[model samples]
Structure formats: C-alpha cells, structure tokens
Target chain A: MDIKPIFKTLIRNPVGLVLIATQVALTLAIIVNSLFIINQRLDNISVKSGIDEDNTLMISFSSLSDSYNMENAIANDLAFLKSLPGVNSAMATNSLPLSNSGWSSGVSSQSDYKGVEIGSAFYFADETLVDTLGVDLIAGRSFRSEEISYYYLSDELEPPVCIVSADLALTLFPDLNNPEEVVGKKIWYGGVENPKFAEVIGVINDIKAPWRGWSEPIFNRVIYVPHKPIFGKFSRYVVRAENGQLDNLVKNIQTELSNFDDQRVIRPPRPFSDIREVFVRNDKGMATTLTIVIVLLLLINALGIIGLVSFWVTQRTKQIGTRRALGATKFDILTYFLTENLIITCIGVIIGSILAMALNNWLVTAFSLSKLPMSYLLGSALLLILMGMIAVCAPAMRAMNVQPAVATRSV
Target chain B: MLKMNGLSKVYRTHLVETHALREFSITVDEGEFVAVTGPSGSGKTTFLNIAGLLEEHTEGSYQLDGIELTGLSDRKRSALRNEKLGFIFQGFNLIPDLNLFDNVDVPLRYRGFSAKERKQRIETSLEQVGLASRMKHFPSELSGGQQQRVAIARALAGEPKLLLADEPTGNLDSNMARGVMELLESINANGTTIIMVTHDPELAARTRRNVHVIDGQVTDLRTVFNNDNVERTAETA
Candidate 1:
C-alpha cells in the first residue's frame, strides 16, 4: 500500500496526531522508569544475607526483675533451647541479621588509631554463634570454648579473640593480598584512650549487618566477638531448627521459655524469614506501587489510541466508503488504519526511548541507581507498538465494515 | 458484459421489510453504453450497486463476463471487483487528503500494481481527464469540476471491463455535466462497457440503450440508436 496518502492525511490533522504521539511518548517514559526502579528494588531485596534464613529463629526478651542475673538467665536459656526437640544449635547474641537494629563499632588496624576506621556491626556471641548462625568459615577457626567470657554493663573487659567477615577483613587490611594472612592480626575495637585489641581468630565468608540500609556497602561488614552474654539486660537467643521445624519451634518456644522463668517478658519468637520481610517491607511496597502505576499507564495509553482511532474512523466514514467502492477490500482498509497508528506509535517510541534514557540518567545521578540497559528500552518499544496495534484493531475493523453503497449516498 | 436475471433486494428491519428491487433484470453488451433512468428511491442505485458487485441481492442470478457472481466469498467478490469493475459517484468521492494523482492510484494500489506501473496508469488516466498538469493538487484545492474529473480519473486508472456511474454528473453545472458526458462517451468508444444511472432523460437519450425502472422493477427497455445508426447520424450531421 502507498503510505504517502496516509501520511498526507495525518499531516492535515497535525494537532491530533501530535497529541497521540505525545501521549505514547509520555507513557513509554513513565513505564520504563517505573520498570527500572522496580527491577532495582527487586534486586536489592534478593541479595543474600549470608545467614541460614529458613531454619533460624530469634527470640528476644528483657529481664523485668532487678534480681535477674543476665549471665545465668542467658546460660539457662541457651541450654533449654538446645535441648528442645528439632533444635540443632543455639547461642545468645547481641543482635540478629535482618533484625533492623543492632550495635556497631569502628575497627582500625593500628592501636593508636592513626588511620581511617571501618564501621562494622558488633555481633557478640558465644563459641556456638558460628555454628548456630550457619556462617561459613573461610579461614582459621572459631573461638575456643575457653575463650568465651561474660560481658556485664559498663565492663571494660576486652575479648581475647574476634572473627571478622571477608569484607571487613579486606577493609581493615587493604595492603594484605590474602585474606588468611589477616586471621591472626590484632585489631582495635573500642576507643583510642583505652584501646581494646582482639586478635582476628577467623574470617567468615559473608555476613550482613542490620544497622544500615542493605543497599549500602557497609551491609556485609561484621565483627563477631566471643561474649557469652551479649548484654546485661536483654537476652536474645539465635536458634537454628532442623529442616521443616521452624513454624513449630516458633509457636512453642515462647511457652517453653516462660516455663523456665516467668519474671522476664519474652517477646514472641520470630522466624528469620519474617524478620527479613519486615526489613525490606518498604522496598516491596515501592515495587508493588510502581508495578500498579505501570499497568494503569499502559491502560490509559491504550485507551487514548482507541479513542483517537475511533474518532478518526467516524470522521472518515465517507472516505472509507469511497475507498471500498474503489475496489479496496476489508483487509486493505484495516491495514491502512493499522499502518497509520503504527507510524504514530513509531514516532512516539523514538522520542520516548531518548526521554526514558534521559530520565534514567537523572535517576542514576539523583539516587545513585544503575544505568538503564538497552534491552529494557527495546523491549518497552516493542511492547508499546503491540499495545498501539491492539488498541487500533477495533476501530480499524469498524472502518473495514463500511458499506460501499454509502459512496452513492450524499453525506 | 453484465447480466442480472430476476434480481431482488430487500431492506429488512424488525418492524418492516422494504423492497428496493424486485425481479430487476438488465444486460449490456461488451462495448455498449447503457443508461438507467429512474425517479428518486426507485432502485436505480440498488441495481447499480448489485451490478458493480458492491452489494448482495436477496434473490438473483447475476453474471459478469460469464462468471457467476452470486454466493461468491467476499474475498473472491472483492478480487473480481478490483480486477474488472470501476465506480464513479455523484458526490465526486475524491479523498480530500490525497492529491489528484494519489486519488487516481487508489484502485491500482488495490490491484497490486507495481509502483512504476501505478504511476504510469495514474498519469495516463489523469491525462485522459485533462487534469495531468494538476495531478499534485488536492481535491480541496480544485474546483467542483476538477474534483469530478479526478474521480473519473480514479475510475479509469484501473482499466476496468465495466464502469458503473451513479449520477456521476448530478453535482455539476450543465456545462461541466456535458464535458463529463463527452468523456464517458469517449471512454465507452474505446469498448469498455458502461451502466450509468441518471435522472436526466437527455443524458439517457445519448446512450446506445435506455432502461427505465419504477417501484423496484424495470418498466421500460429501448434502444435509442445502434452503433451503425449513431455513425451514420454523425456523418450526416
């Protein structure tokens, strides 16, 4: 078919064509940006926490009685949790991964704090912390049983040994090529005035901290110290259950702890997966909202095309009848309308691709997001074209069904 | 050549059934120019539509160039129409957005002619209508007569075997009507069959044969002049 005639027709109605094209372009820009943000959030949510998320459960409680000895209560709690049915291992720790709140301290290679200090989450647990959290040891060994010690409130006791994550170890000793070489190196944890040095006994593969946003680089920097009672008031136990035993353990663990001692207020036991869900709930909500907006945008864009095409069809009824009388078939009429819409959509898509990339660039500069890939742009262009075609189908069919006899009648 | 026997057309609704044509019949030889005259709403347009294969009849046996037309699929009928028929309307139905040349190319495009062939045919047809120099002018840019000529050029570009004109000169002044009539006569002189529906007796008298329709039926059939009689009359004049 000769598109020259169609082009001429469209040029005559420049305002209408431009409006449709602008609508398509804006729709493309909005949807592409929304998709990019949604994808980024999804990727952030899917990052590995380097913990046994499915099998681990955390129980947090505070000792309400002033006479409650934190050391004895935590020891009793750990023993009771470990003896429970289907419980693999248990340890009392200061904080749990994905808990959304934890303790953090700065670590430095020099005892005099002469250089920059790297911030890391302080994960103080007993000798069983490594096994209970399911963190893999890449080099050296975990703290020995004799190395475990109690930490009271405002106590100045320095731990004999500590374990660092692979990321933290690299940050602490950037000059060292091998991670194993930093295993025995001593690092300062507390203030410079009373510098508490603990030898790095082991290097864990990767463990995420709960102090900051997961998107930050400091998320995986963790330093584990051998402190049996992580705090004086609160006793938080990290318990690992056998396969398929999480839901049952979470349901009965509160009652079991209460039976052991009723003075402390035991919060409900929570699965690690639930805590992770709470940690990233805001991101999930943003992704869902963006997805909804994209769907609505596509629907509105499709409706715009349908409305414009239907109006054009109605306006050109006599012209369609004339073409029908001139030996143009139904398919010819349908193709003419579809091709006209395709031209408009193509123009819009071309403009929209540039607009989408520019918007993505702004997003990267403003929020530090990754650049939008070409695959998304091409995919969105194809999707918009398909949407335009679908939206034009009904109006094109209406044009196709115009009777040739209408040409004989006066308009 | 065209033939229709016992053709009937019924326009139906839930409350009424109106007969547009009943037992209508006509035939035109391959090289003959025939005019159909009727009062308003007397079914001349219905006959023209059926004869052009633009519509279906309620009851009929129609044949065009010896091929059965009734009960054919829409695709087959459209192919036949594209291959063998052309139409000119009283409204001078030139698509306003297209220029004269593009207007003439409509049927050729549907006929699947190559670009070069379509361009040649469009030029030739526009030249025949004396509008070749104004081929790039849009319909809105031309006068009424010029637009009609473009519509006629559109009809001629397909080189159809049968040309159907429904009051093709109805919208024109007398002078413009005569010019279009002369053009039709010249086209028919080249041996293309024509069936023209008109309300003017004078125009009908100029054709080789005249058929009068009334109340959805053919009421009269007469030959105004044979080819030999027309030639002799022309020579004597």
Candidate 2:
C-alpha cells in the first residue's frame, strides 16, 4: 500500500480527519476515567485492615425475645463459646471495625475546649478485647484486666479517663508534640446534658466500625471506651482461634450452645477479612460499572469509525474507479484506503493518548482517585489502535469491492 | 490493434431485460483511426466500454494488444486497460482535485514509474498538448478546449497501444472542438490506433474510416481520402 497518497488525501479533507479525532478523544476519555476508578478501588483493597483476619471468626446474633436477658445472655454465650475446644478467646462487642452503622460522639481534649466537632467510632470491650480483636498498640497501653471499666468516672469532680486514637489526639490538640503524652490528659464529651469529663487512660491505634463509618484516614480518628459504666448489650461475639481452625471452633461452639436455647441461632462464621469486604462492596460495584461503561464507549467509537470510513469509500468511488482504470490492481485499491484509515487512526491515537493523560488528571481531582498510572494510558492507547483496525476492516472491504466501471459513468 | 467477435451485453432488471449490444463484431488494425458514429442511446458507448475493459460483455471474444479480454480477472483487466489503452471522455473527465501535471502523472504512477521518471513523462505529455506552461493549473481553471487537451494528455502519458475517445468534442464550441479534433488527429498520425465515438457526422467524416451504427447494429462503413493535390486547392479557395 502506498501511504504517500493516502496521507495527502487525508490532509486535503480536514473534515474526515476531524471526525476520526472526535471518536478517538471520546474513547480515550472514558477509558482513562474507568482505569483511574479501578486503580483507586485496588488501592483501597490493599490497605491493611488492622485485624488478624485468618485466626478470627465474627459471629453476629440478635436477641429475639420480649424480655431479653441482655447481660446474662451475652456473658453466658461468651463463657460458653470461649470454653469450646480450639477457641483461643472470645470478646463481646457492639460493633466490629469496617462494619456499617454505629454511634459517634464529639471528642474534646479539655472539659471546656471550644472546637469544631470531631467524630469518632466508639468500641466497648473488656480487657481480653485487645488479644481477641488483634488491634495494634502504637502508644501508651491497653486497659489492664481489672482496671478496664473504672478508669473513667461520671462525676465532674473525679479525674477523667478515656483513650483517643493518634488521629484524634492530633485534631484535638494540633500543637501537641507527642501522641503518647496526650494519653494522660483529660477530655470531655456528652456536651450540655451529661457533660462528663474523662482522663485519657490508654491510646491504641484507631479502628473502623462498619456501622459507625470512619471518615477519610480511618486510623487517625477512633475513640475507645472500656466495657462498663454506661453500656448496652452487644449483638455480636467474635472468637479468636489459636490454631486457625475456624471451622472446628465454630462447630464446637455451636454444639456447646445447642442446649442453652433452641431459639437462639448461630449465624454462619466468617473471617474478619470477609466481614470487612462488605463495607467496601459499593466501591467494587462502582469499579465494575465503570468497566462496563468504558466497554460500551469503545463500541460506540468503533461504530463511528466504521460509519465514517463507509462514507469515505462511497465518496471516493469514482476516484477509485479512475485509479483502477489507470492501472491500480484490486490490491492497490484496497491498500489505498486501508493506509488512509490507518493514517487517520494513527493521528487519532496520538491525540487520544494526550487527551487520556489530561482526562486522567481531571478524573483524579473530581473523584479523589489516586494518580493515573502510566500502564493504564499505554494499555488504553493499544486498545484504541486495535479498535481502529476492527472498525476499518468492513470499510476497506467495501472500497476494494468497487468496480472500475463505476467511474466511467456519472458517479 | 483490437478485435471483437460476437460481442454481446445484456442488462437484467427485476421486470425487464435489455440488450445493449448483440453479436457485435469489429476489428481495427495498427495505426488506423476508426470513427464509430451512432445516435444517443446507441451501442457506441457500450462498445467503447467493452473495448476499454471498463465493463464486461455478457458473451464476447475480445482481443486487445493480443490478450484475450474474456475470462480474465478484474485485476488483470485493470492492468490491461492501464497498460494497453487510453481513454478520453466527452466531459473532459479530469480529476478535479489534481492539477494538470498530476492528472497526467496519475496513470504513470500506477505504472510504477520512479518519481524522476514520472515527472519527466508528465512534462513531455503536457508539452505535447501545448499546455506545458499551464501544467500546474487545475482543470477547472482551463477552457473547455484546454481541459480536453489535458484529458488527452492524461491518456497519452501512458503511451498505450490503443486510444479510446468517447465524443471527443461533444461538449465544446466549434472553434474549441476543431482544436481538440486536430490534436487527436495529430496524435493518431503519430501511429497510435484511435477509435473515437462522435455524434457529429462532419467530425466523423474527417477520420480515415467511419463506421455508422443504428440501434445496436452497424449500418454502414465509409472511408474518405482526398488527394493532397485537390485538398490544397480547396484550402486556397
């Protein structure tokens, strides 16, 4: 195929060239945005969940009686489940990290500190909670076995006690040089009505409750309260298995509890990682929808290319006939238009590549996505080139099929 | 040289059948300028189309430059047409997008001439048509006579064995038509076999031989040659 004439022809007809550019630009824009979204979801998935996923079994059960024996049922269930073979330890908590929906309250450093409201997810746990949930302690210490519930007092005259995450510590007192030192300070909550002030007892790393929901930067913002004083019955108990035999432990625990209450149901056991996945399910769905949209956009671009090429072949029928009469083989005619479409496609691909990069930046800013990686740009460019080939094939065949005699007559 | 034996073309439609040509036959020897004259809608154009390999005849035996035209593939037909024949249309059908020089150069490029060779051939052909200086001008920029000259130049550049001109001066005034006819005569005199289809009996009479056709059959054949001794006196008078 001679490319020189095809390029000359394309340069002469700016309208056809512009049509190709439009298709390429649209294709690249959608592809870049879709890739950016997928990358962001993947980044979210790889962030550490801050829990020992394998050795943990999260079992949620709700009370189903008119007069629920909240404290007795929970205590009895925990004791019974923990005594089962293969069970390392068990803790009853109102919510788990990365679980959807829970309570939040304003946390402040001093009793009278006037500041913007800071939201933190609340967790209620016994002393064994630290070992059972597998959260890290970045500073200070976990609540002692006997001292977990007595650290904070309801009266204003008594010394305040509570633990805030490193993130909350920073937000409450931005000038504080050390998060560990912030632990011993007094903070107040339950503004106006209860107005209780508490001393910081131990600061552990932040945790997410799927229900309460963390704002951005989850680790920097949760508040931990010991399981005593003001409390409600927890709906769930998580058992940590020492041997990672979660199935064995669930079987033994369910058997031990079968005689306690026939009406009480043990929900299926799931690893903590599987439980956390439910919190980010929306992100996965968004990524899948974006992929489908990009695929549809690519198909639209392919159709547009085919339409434009068909128009070109129709318009150039006489010229093709003339060329054949002048000594162009059928192969020559086919090659002429193939080279023409390819030339147009190459230009569009080059322009589309540039547009893809610019569109990636816009997507990142608009969607809070991580930076668009180079691989996505390169991959999309290649896909568009292949799309051009597929789009041109039908038109090329039509051009080649034109008879030389068509030029002899008016058309 | 060209030969046609039992040439036939049939057009089929859903409700009708039309025979454009039937059992048509003709032979032109080397260096002969044959004029094919017929009224509008006659089979002159069909014969030209078949002879030039532009359209296929339904049943025919055609030999042009010693190669059988029937049973040949479209590609081979295109090659034969490009290499062995030249075409001149009534409308001076030059590609509007290309300049005079490039229009002539178009066929040469298909012949795979190098860039240097294509340029040389284009200049020489344009010079032959007395439009060498206007080689860069487009066909629309020229007069009817000049445009036809360019078309002739386009055909001549290929150096074909046979030249086919359909209504060579059909669209021009008397003066411009005379000029185009003279150029074609000069080209034929250079030993290229020319078969021209013209509606003008006067123009057809000027050729060495005239074959007249009515409907789809040849009606008469005539040849005119005036001695130079009597022609000189007629010019002087």
Candidate 3:
C-alpha cells in the first residue's frame, strides 16, 4: 500500500543491493552460455551424415606380414570375401565410412597451368567399389572393369583418367549448365615431368567422413584410381551384407579369414550411428563441461544471495523488531523481507540482462558461436527470482522471530 | 482508564535470577496525569515498559479500556499496544531516517487507516505540538525539544487511550524540557491519561499524582499541596 517507505528502506542498504547484483549477473552469464552450448551440440547432431550407412560393414587388415606377397594376398582376400554367403557387394579401400581418415592430392591442367587449382580426395578402389558402396552416379558412370589396364599408365608416364563427385564438379564450374560438360576436361596431377592427365569420367553424390563438417561442403574434391598390382599390407575390406545377416556375415568372414593369420585382430562391427557418435564425442564433452560450470555458478549465486539476506536480517534486527511491535504480523514481516529481496533481485536481473548481452557478443566473436537468445535471458531472470525467494527465506524467518522487546530497549 | 494489580517482573539467567518489579500496583483514571519518580535502576523503566505492553510481566494483571492483558498472548499484546497505548522515550525515539510527517504517520499506518486519514491525523497532531510547518524536516535537522515533540506527536497521532512517557525530556536543555512538559500537561488536560516517569522531582510535583518506586516496590503514593487531590499509603514494616 505504501511503497515509498519500502523503497526508502531499500536505498538505505547498499551491501544487500550489491550482493543481489552479483548473484544475478553470474546466473545470467552461465545460463546463457550453457544454453548456447546445448544448442550448438544439437545442431551438429542433426546435420546429415551424407552416405547410405545401413548396409555397410568395414573390416580392416592392416598388419599382413610383408613375407607374404601383399598385392596377391589383398587381391585374393577381396575375391574371397565377395564370394561368401550373404555378402552382396564389397570393396577394398584404405578406409570406410566414418573412419575420418582419407588421402588428399592437388590437381591442375597440363604444364604451367598452376594455381592452387583444385584439391581432390583420392580413393584407390577397384571398378566395382562405387557400386558396392551404393553411391549415386549423378553424371557420367562408374569406372569400367575392362579399362583397368589403361587405368594405370607407366610410372614415369601420364594417365589420363580419374573420377570426381558432383560437389567438386559444381565448385570447378559453377556457371556451367551441365555438370557433364567438364567430364572430359584434362586435369594434371603430380609434377609436370611425370604429370598424369585425369579425365573426370563420373560424378557421385557428396560423402562425409563426419569429422570434416567444418571443411566438407566447401571442398568436396576427390579423385579415384583403380587398385594397382603393387600394394602394401595396409588396406580394408568393406562389405554390404544382405539385409539382417550382418552378424552371421561377420562370423562367416571371420571364419573364412581364420586360415590367413593366427594373430589377426578383428574388432566387432560398430553401427553407423555409433561410429558417427564417436566423431561427435568431443561435442558431448564440451556440453557436459559447460553444464557443470553452469550448475556451479548457479549454486554460488544462490549462496551469495543467502549470505546477503542473512546479513541484511542481522543488520536490521532493531528495525524488524520495531516493525513487529507496530502491529505487523509474522506473515507481514516475512512478506516484507521477501518482497524487498524480490525488488533487489529484479533490479539486479535488469542490469545482468544488459551485462549478458555484452558478454554474449564477446563470446560469440571469440568462439564463433550463435548469437545469444532473448528467451534464455528472460528465462534465467525468472529463475533467479525464484532462487532469490528461496535465498531470502532463512533471513525472513529470522526477521519474523525477532521479539518486539528487543527494539523497545535503548540501543 | 489504566489499571495494574499485583504486577511483578522477574528476569532470569542461567546463573542468577533478579526481580525488576515486585507486586507493583497503580491506577490512573481518565483525564488524570500520573508521574512515577525514582532513582536510576529503581524499576521505573520496567514499570513504564510493562504498562506500555512493550515487555511481559512475570506476574500480575493489567487492564486498559476494560480489556484484560495478563492472559493475552504476545501478538494480542502488540495489537492492544497499537490500538490503545502510545509510547514516548527518553532518547526521543523518533526513527532517525523518517521525516517528522512520516514519523507521526507510522502508528496510523499500522492501524491500517486510509492514506488520507493518516495525513489528516499527522497534520493535526504535529499542529498540536507546534510542528505542523516542520513536517518535512528529518529528526536530526530539528532541535532536541523539536525531536521530542515529534516523538510525542507520533504517539499522539495514534489517539491512544493512554500515553506512556519514559523521561520524554531527559535529553533536552531546561527550556526544551519545560516546553515538552508543558505540551504533555496540555495533552493530558484534554482527557488523555498520561503516565510519565521522571527523575526531576519538580516535573513530578507538577503532575496530579506522584508515585515513588524504590527497590522494585512503590513506596509512596502522595498528592501534593498545589492540587485538591491528596492521598497517602505507607509500605508494610
């Protein structure tokens, strides 16, 4: 009813005001940033993984002994695995989906055609590798098996052959109407003396290795060559099992390869989603750490508010007693203290909202995160008000318990 | 009218127990001015506190406006204090932060009166103390007598049935003390019963009745020569 007196009392106490300000400010900072971290993690998860994953299983053989002819062993292994039951198609390559490992090489056209030009992701696969992976051939076609002999030219000679993805084709020729127009354009690889002119005979849809979202869409460049006869022991066999027999297919493959080596290590096949999760595991860690820091800050803010209100109750003991003697009920005294705190808290939240906006700008600039959301700030302020009430309860109890006689006595 | 019967106050500690008032009894009818006089620590303050309902009595009964006080709880005592009694203290216990107007308005505020009614009462009470024009001045800005008057005006604004003054002029110079005493006399003459405690025998002589308290007991009940009222009671040997 008489708000002027209440406000006058508030102005008389500066320490309590400062404490409320600090608590609200800290709450705003932590809540806003934690919400941002959560949003960013969710955003990363929803981005497409970019390749068909349900029918794929990757098996690696990186430790075959050199005493065994490596090229013959790999060729024999690919042939044997493809012929097994429940195995529809398979490819032998250096890595599989979600492996986050790949090779990159630079490209140019003829001699002296030098600019950084284009970078290509190189995959050494057999003719059937593209079909086995179920990649969409957007333009042109997959490499033919009959052209294997010409796929590899002399070591000191040029090989006019390669395949690329449609994303790379678009990047190289954004103004062109037909992506296939540049299919035969000559691109040279390596030094000019041993330069290889590769024709972009086919274009496939884009693929993501999951760890490369930050760089993938801008530079989806790649080149594929036929598997060479001279090979190393380091290679993988990717198999697409028939429908639901992946476990059986794995057991059969493990049994089929048991005769090759005694000390072979064949890890269980992880699902595509699990593999993608491994790539985004760092996002999870970031979110968890932000969450913990936010919780700690909130707890600290709550304690600060409690300490402030306690100090306030103690300082105003005489005044509270006087108020009680002046016909104020215990509920009246409690409401007075609680309302005072709410006022201080609301003021602090207003200032803190401004402070959070400034801090959010600085954070977004430093960390390149999204802008601060207004809803997060408003929601945090409401939360601070509720927390402020809880914080004031202890001190309100003290205020209501003060005997009227205390103020009656002098000093 | 205010009445007390067999009133006593005892303060106890873990190690010692002390009696502040022993069977103290007095009665003040409407329109009477009663002055209680004693040396420091002679239970005069305790008497004033108990009469004002500011403290609880260890034993005894008190009645104001025909309402019993001994059986009432602390909350009820507070309500009675707010509704029926007003207090003025030796220290001129005006809230230092509030201006004269707001100070006088406090008791009325507790009474839950309308804002307009509080303003009217505050102005009338301040005018009675010759402080209507100084309503906006804070306690520290006024002289000692003015502060005491403001304290009296604060009590008066409540329109209490009984006014309790505890050394109301103790901190003032002679001139200010006399001025405050005269104001109390005038307020009392208007039919508001006043029970004041004073160390100055001269101020005690001016009241209609004087009660001398010593060692937690009232030793003398006397009416002096200047008035038609005269009575005496001797303590038991």
Candidate 4:
C-alpha cells in the first residue's frame, strides 16, 4: 500500500483526521491507566492471607443476662466444637485474619526506644488458636494448659510470654540470620515509662495483618498472646472445619451453640471467606467500575473511527469511482482505507504513549500509584489498531461498491 | 484497435429495466481517431464506459486488441484496463489532493512500474502536456484548461493502446476547449488511437471519423469503412 499520497490527502483535509486521532489518543491514555489500576485492585483482592480462609469461621455474641458465666460457657463451646465430626480445631479469640477488625500495640527491641518504634497487631486466644487458624508454626512449642489464662482489658496486665510472627521476630532482632534464633529473645510492648517485656516463646511463619498491601512494615508483623479475652458479657470464637463442610458447620454451630445455656444468645457464625469479601469489597467495586470505563472508552473510540470514516466514504464517492476507473480493484480500495486508518492510528498511539507516561507520573505524584509498564502500552496500542481496522471495515466495504461509471456521470 | 458487435447495456430494477445501449455496433482500427457525438440520454457516455471497461455490456461481444472481454474476472478487467486502456473524464478527475506529477503517476503505479520508471513517465507525460514546470501544483491551483491537460497527461502516461475520453473538454471555455482539442489531435498524431465523446459539432468535424447516436443506438456513420481498416457485423447500426 502506498501511504505517501494518502498522507498528502489527509494533510490537505485534516479535520476528520485530527478529530479521530485526538479521540484515539485520549482513549489510549485513559484506558491504559484504568487497566493498570484495575489489575492492581484485582491483585490486592487475590493476595494470600496467612490462614485457612475457606475452612475457618468466626462468631461473636453478647450475653443479655447477668448470670452468664464467660469462663464456663467458652469451655463448653470449645468442647462441643472439637467433638463435631468435621471440626479440625476450635478456640475463642479477639480477631481473625483479613477480617478488617484488629487490635494493635507498640513493640521495640531497645529498652530506651522512645516512641512506638515497631508497631504490630495483637491476637488474643487460647493455646489452640494457631492450630485452629491452620497457620504453620515453624518454630514454636504449644502453650501448656497452665500457661494459658483469661485476660481482662481493664486490668492493663501484659502476658509474660508470647509467640511472634517471623517478620516481627526479624524486626525485633535484625542481626539474627535465622528467624528461629529470635524465638527466645526479649521483646517490650506498652508505653515508654512503664514498658513491659515478654519472652518470645515461639516464632510462627508470618500472619498477614488486616490491610491492603502486605509490603508495609506493620502488616505482617504480629504478636499472638495465649489468652482468651474475659470481657464479662460478650465474647468471640473461631472454629476450623474440614474442607467440604465449612458452610454447613457454620450453619449448625450457631444453632447448636445457642442451646448451651438459657442466658446464651448466639450470633450467626461467619465463614472467613465472607470476612475476606468484606475486606476487599471496595477493591472489587473499583475494579468492576474501571473495567466498565475501559469498555466505554474503547467503544467510543471505535465508533468515532467508524463515524468519521463513513463520512469520508460518503463524501468521496466521486473520488472512489474515479480511482476504480483508473484501474483500482475493490481490494485496492479496501487496502487504501485500511492503510490510511493504520497511519492515523500509529500517530495517535505514539502521542498516546507519551501522554500515558505523563499521566502515570502525575498518578504517582498525586495518588501514590506505581509506574505504568511498557507491555501495557504496546499491547493497548496493538489493540487499538486492531479495533480501528475492524471499525473501518464496513465503511471501506461501502466505498468499494461505488461503480466506475460515477466518474463519467454528471453529479 | 477495438470492436463491439450488437452490444447492449441494461439497467434493471424490480419495476423497470432500462436499456442504456441497444445493438450499438462500431469498429475502430489502429491509428484512427473517432468522435462519438449525441444528445443527452443518447448513450454516448454509456458506449464510452463499455469500451473503456468501466461498465459491463449486458449483451453481445466486445474485444480490445483481439482479446474477448466477456466473462473475464474483475481482476483481469482491472489489469486489462491498467495495461491497455486509459480514460479522461469531463470533471478533469485529477485527484484533488495530488499534484500534477503524482496525478499522472496514479495509473503507472497500477501498471506495476517501479518508482524510477513512474517518475520518468510522469515527467515525460507532463512535459508532453506543457505542464512539466508546474508538476508540483495541485489541480485547484490550475485553470480548467490546465487541469484538463493534466487529465490528458494522466491518460497518456500509461501509454495505453486505446485512449477513451468522456466529454474531456465539456467543462472548459471555448478557448480552453480549442486548446484541449489541439492537444488531443497532437496525441493522436503520435499514433495513439483516441475515441472521444463530444457535444460540439465543430470538434466532431475535426476528427478522422464521427459516429452519432440517439436513443441508445448508433444512427449515423461518416467514415468510409474499407474491409482493410474495419471489421464489423451486419447489425441495425
């Protein structure tokens, strides 16, 4: 296909050329960035949290009667859950992973560390909490029955011994090469004046905090204290069920646990999958919204190309018939329009690439987004070119039908 | 050389079938310049279109340089048009975006000539029309006479065996038409067969032969057709 003459023609009448090209450029910029953002949100939604998400269930309930025995009631619940056919392990705890609910505290390696140096989430549960959550404890000894105790927040008392995530262990003792070596190290939590120290009895493989990105310093840093909260009226517990029975187990557990005592009022047990959905709901919504935006932009760009090229075909009927008389085949007519549209698309993509990078830079400065990759630019450019070709096909076919006799007739 | 025997063209719709040309038989030998003159809706342009292979004849036989043109594929017709025939239209049909040189090069490109050959032919053709100095000027920048000359140059650039002109000077003033007529005569003097459709009787009188048409059929012939110069069928025309 010869492009020089077509370029000359477009240069002479650049209105349609400029309009479609500008639309293509703007569409490329916005769609490329929006695609990247959608991909990021999808990635966040799919990231792995350090727990058996599909098999775990968390349930919270508050007793309405004053006669409710927190200690005896929790024991009865654990015994009944552990004896169920599909149950793996059960424990009462203050939190679950990826639930968007959390308790945090400050920890440090130095006694003189002034402010909150290393922040970490705190999970309070009994000796079976790690096993119930199905997290791998790489270097740890299970807490003995005597060591586990009930904790009340009003006392402001700190646990003497705790298990730490490998990440938090590394941060507390940076010089240690192996995370297991820091299992017995001294760690301090609480305020500066009355700082309390706990001996790290174990080190577990990282537990993800309730957050979006795991790369943040505090998201993977956690301290698990072996204590079930003894708040007088309300309590929360987590249970792990066998793989295929999680939803059924949750349904039965709520009804069964409500029969434990007359004062007991059981809330519905929630699968951890639901908790995960709650955490990433906004990200999912954003990804869906941006996907719609990308689709709309593409449709608009394609229709713009079709509208402009169709108008050109209608305007140049005489010109096409003249070309046909001058020995151009129908195939030649189609090729001419395809090549012309390709040239216009190339110009738009080149400018759009530059605009994409500029928009990405602003995104980085304004919204803390990462840089746009080159693959997306190349891929989207090729996509737009393909779209332009498909969009121009109908008009080109219409141009091809113009009879050679039109050039001779007085019109 | 060109031949047409009882050629007919029909334009059909569901309700009406229009016969544009009927029993239009004519034969022009090598090196003969013929003028086709008729009134409006007399099928002069239709005859030129069929002879140029721009439109197909619905009936009868047509040949160019002894090769039968019926039942040939579109590709073959296009190739034949590119290699054997050239056209000049009334509108001066010079692609408005292209300059004179590029306009002349259009047909040569379809002929599959290389860049150097096309450039050389375009320069020579434009030079023949006395517009080589204005090769870079677009048609809009030229006068009606000059644009018609460029169209003639485009037709001549392919060095086609037969040149077809459909009212080539219809849009020009008298002076411009006279100048274009002189250029066509000089081109015919160089041994290129020319068939021109004209509305003016003075231009028709200038040609070596004249064929007149009315109501989709040829009605008069002013040339002496010796067997050595023309081969024709015994038909109504």
Q: Could you tally the backbone clashes for each prediction?
A: 0, 18, 2, 0
| Most TM-score-accurate candidate | 4
Can you give the lDDT of residue A173 in candidate 3? Answer: 63
Q: Return whichever of 2 and 4 wins on DockQ.
A: 4
True contacts kept of each: 0.64, 0.52, 0.27, 0.66
Residue B179 local lDDT, model 1: 92
Q: For candidate 3, write residues B1-237 as lDDT tens digits.
A: 878889899999999988999988877789888899988889998888888877889998888888878878776877788888878878766666678898787778778899899999999999999999999888889999999999899888889999988888888999999999999999998989999999898898888778888998886566655456555544431
lDDT for model 2? 0.75
TM-score of chain A of 2: 0.73
Instruction: List residue ranges in candidate 2 displaced over 4 A.
Output: A42-75, A82-90, A93-97, A100-231, A239-278, A364-368, B226-237
> Where does the lowest 10-residue lDDT sum fall in candidate 1 chain B?
B228-237
Q: Write the per-residue lDDT of candidate 1 for residues A1-411, one digit (tens) a residue.
A: 667778888897687779988988988988888888898889768867788889998898898877788878888888888999989999877778768888787779988888768788888777886679888888889988789888775777588789989988988899988779998999897878878899999999868888454344678889888886546567788899998999999999999999888989899988988888998888899999999998898899899999989999998898888888777889999999999999899989999998999999999899887899988888888999999999999999999999877777777
True contacts kept of 1: 0.64
lDDT of all predictions, in order shown? 0.86, 0.75, 0.74, 0.86
DockQ of 2: 0.39
> For residue A194, what is the lDDT in candidate 1?
79
Model 4, range A1-411, lDDT digits (tens) per residue?
688988998898888888888888888898889889999999879867788888999887788878777888888878988988899999888887677777887789876665337888888867886679888788867566677888776867588888888988888787899877987777887768888888888877858776644435677888888788867788888998988989788778887777755577788888888888998899999999999988898899889999989998988999898888889888889999999999899888888888988999999889889899998898889989999999999999999888888888789
lDDT of 3 by residue, A44-98 (tens): 6554544556667777654545565555556677777777887778766655445
Q: Estimated TM-score per prediction?
A: 0.92, 0.74, 0.73, 0.94
Tens-digit per-residue lDDT, B1-237, candidate 4: 899999999999999999999988888899888899889999999999899988999999999999999888888888898888889899998888888988998888777899999999999999999999999999999999999999999999999999999888899999999999999999999999999999998898778788888899986556555755753332336
Mark the 10 consecutive residues where model 4 chain A has the least summed lDDT: A209-218
Checking candidate 1 for backbone clashes, the offending pairs are none
